[model samples]
Target: MIHRLQNISELIEVSSRMGSDINLIQATGGNTSIKIDGYMIVKASGKHLANAFSENIFVETNPQDYYYNKNGDIKIINPKKSSIREGDLKPSIECNFHALLPKKIILHSHPIEIMAHTMLNSFHSKADLALKGMNWKYINYAKPGEALAMEIAKSMKVDNNIYILANHGLIVCADTVKEAERLQSNVINKLKLNRRVLKDCELESLENIVESIPDAYLPNNKIIHTLGSDEWSLELARKSAYSPDHAVFCGIYPLIIKDINQDWKRLMQGHTYAIIEGKGVILFENSGKYLEDMLLAQAEVFARIPVEESVTTLSINQCKDLVNWEAEKYRKKMLEKLVK
Candidate 1:
């Protein structure tokens, strides 16, 4: 037990660093795991990587413990034999591939640098030149969890250690924690791009939009206002491009208010966020930091994308699949309890 927790501690150290870097991960969006003596300890569903050090946010499981049905739902082989920890916590939905992978250490992250390219329509044509000579394969978009794990498993080769998950993020696998960290840093440095600078946000317009929204909704911060003041970013916010966390936390699309004078709240369209065009951004009432980070993450990803690159968005079906997923709902519920 002590040895396992020791391994978990190392993973937490790696995860804590990853969580603190907004450009790498935000809120409880990413997960980490380490395989030890045939047992794997992975981040719990919807738990914050940043809080792993301070909380019991990992679960012990084996690849053989769970299986996917024809309907693609994950099922435990013997629920009665499952760990007591699993009574309230479970491995991340992404743990399927982690357990099945050949590597001993895995770090899955939503890197802004990598996501910038995955969102690009032209990334496939440009990948060879961008990551030439690297052991990386770009996995096409798939619904998260079992489906995504299988997609990656099919594409993986003996030498491929890094995977660029299209419309998703980056995955780096290694045999040791230090080696994993080193590889991740190399990938980030290699793929990182300079963000397109935005002009200063119009404060008066931002204030006006803030006043128009119900008092319950407030701007997360003055920084997110740049998302609305810029025409291109405002357009990007509407779709948020199917990154699983954004869809799960912030909803499929944001409510766009072209004119604040219109009945804005009624037009929310069930979205938790309202991007007031020409003004700034506002969160729905009772918004949590998870949603806040994802909102800013949406803005960050869209801003880094070049204007000419046609962005790929998740299909309506894809968004529906992620938003309505039972596992995600559990994660959201867990996130609130663990992170706070």
Candidate 2:
């Protein structure tokens, strides 16, 4: 275990750097892990990657013994079984996948570019052309945690090193930390696609509407801008959420304000932002950076979607499933805790 101890700093540094990139991970949406000997070190639950290196945000575990409880939920295996350090923080819900994979390092990210492709109905086939140089496994959307790990195990191939979780994100595994970083870079470079840029006029128009709303719902100091004034973005906002991340962070669908006469109180009850027809989007008071990032991500996903292809958005039922899941509830609670 001496070798593992020597590499702990590297693992923390890499994970912290990855978290610092808003394009790769926003808030506490991603996780990283390292396995050495009989122990596995994983990002603690609800902990931001940006804090990985600065704080004791990692938990060590014995991966060999894990199982489900009577309620069919996976127990938090060896949550307190640690040799490196101790804390009250919980391990990431994704620790199951990290433990299952035999690689020395595992990095999972909800990169907007990668998720943009995965959110589409044609990701499995389209990704082939986009990432032709590397072998990747595309797994359909599964509930996070054990369910996701099970699907990954079933889909794992002898040659593929990357796994793209549909409507979610990407996972890369490698025998060495340097190789893992290289693979992630390669995937990002290959998945590059053009996106629509909102012009100054479009942004000003949205700001005008936002300023007009005298209600407390719209914040005056915060930035006001449309994700995109393009047809694709507007259309995407009209549908149900495209992924669990969207469903949880944003809302099931954006509330479109066709007329200012609409009941503002009722509309903003559970939602954080609203889209105004022929104007733009307006967020609630003190919406903060996390909500803004999610809106931008939503816009990017829509912009990258092929005009001819019909995207596969989360169904109402599926959206409900995600919102009602205990894991998501805990994550949301933790996010709220962090914000405070």
Candidate 3:
């Protein structure tokens, strides 16, 4: 008979293991949770998985009553301590999505290879076809938190072990934490094999691309929009190495806007970044900066892997599939707008 998972420690260990195994969560791009008794054990916000131990993992409130603010941050009502308030420690911004899974354990991550496929518009159907026998659901890109959680809840019926967040990442759920970990591994391994098949078809080149920008483009008040002038290097790295396919979808990089006002203006002006296959892309808006940073970091890590260690590249057909998928996405958006 299956044993019930006992305490917070067990949940913490399981959550930590999932974070370690799936290359999706680096530093802290991903979060994990497990239900015990009436409480949910979730990874503490701003805590890195590599260093996350038991004690500091704050337990603020129950999963059922979690709330989302206007900015999409999660707020929990803590009956225990008034100062130890719901929104006090600020749970993972993605906590609501984690809370919605019917399983005891939920894992989410931004795995690079999987993300490479996810960022492409065409890959979801291809991925669905690829994982034909397994039970899963896919939800299109929505700003994270309440909106995304609501969309997933609407789309999913059966308690599938995995959910693919379109243009984002993967979510795995299982009866036990160990089972969830295993499922996550199996999914990653399959995606890795798919990536290898694509990589083997042809090698994309990155020869003779300009690696440096002129001094004029260097960080200045005009250019340093959101991250401040000090983060210029960080911004540059983000633009340079963000995923190639993401460039096609989200633009080369997001524009760095300071506040909502600037963001609104930029969106109105239609000034967005685009991706190039080998070369890096730039970031524009701060909202997408976290994703850009994560992709850039992953690219850097991949760069260190020797050429022989690299898997096969994606094919033109695969690329075209992504483009077609994006077109459909736009069409759907237009239809929605018309309906509105």
Choose the strongest candidate by TM-score.
Answer: 1
Location of the lowest summed lDDT over 10 successive residues in candidate 2: 219-228
* Candidate 1, number of clashes: 0
Better of 1 and 3 by lDDT: 1
User: In candidate 2, which residue pairs clash?
Assistant: none
Predicted candidate 2 versus true structure: per-residue lDDT over 251-290, tens digit per residue: 7877776676666667656667777765566777646447
Worst 10 residues of 3 by lDDT: 197-206
lDDT of 1: 0.76
The segments of candidate 2 whose C-alpha lies over 4 angstroms from its true place after superposition are 1-7, 67-86, 197-201, 214-224, 286-289
> Please, what are the lDDT tens digits per residue for candidate 1 over residues 84-129?
3555777788877777566889999999878877888877777777
Tens digits of lDDT, candidate 3, 84-126: 2334345555667666566777878767666555544456556
In order, candidate lDDTs are 0.76, 0.73, 0.49
- Show model 3 residue runs off by greater than 4 Å: 1-6, 67-88, 193-340
Number of clashes recorded per candidate: 0, 0, 24
Off by over 4 Å in 1: 66-87, 262-269, 338-340
Q: Give the TM-score of candidate 1.
A: 0.90
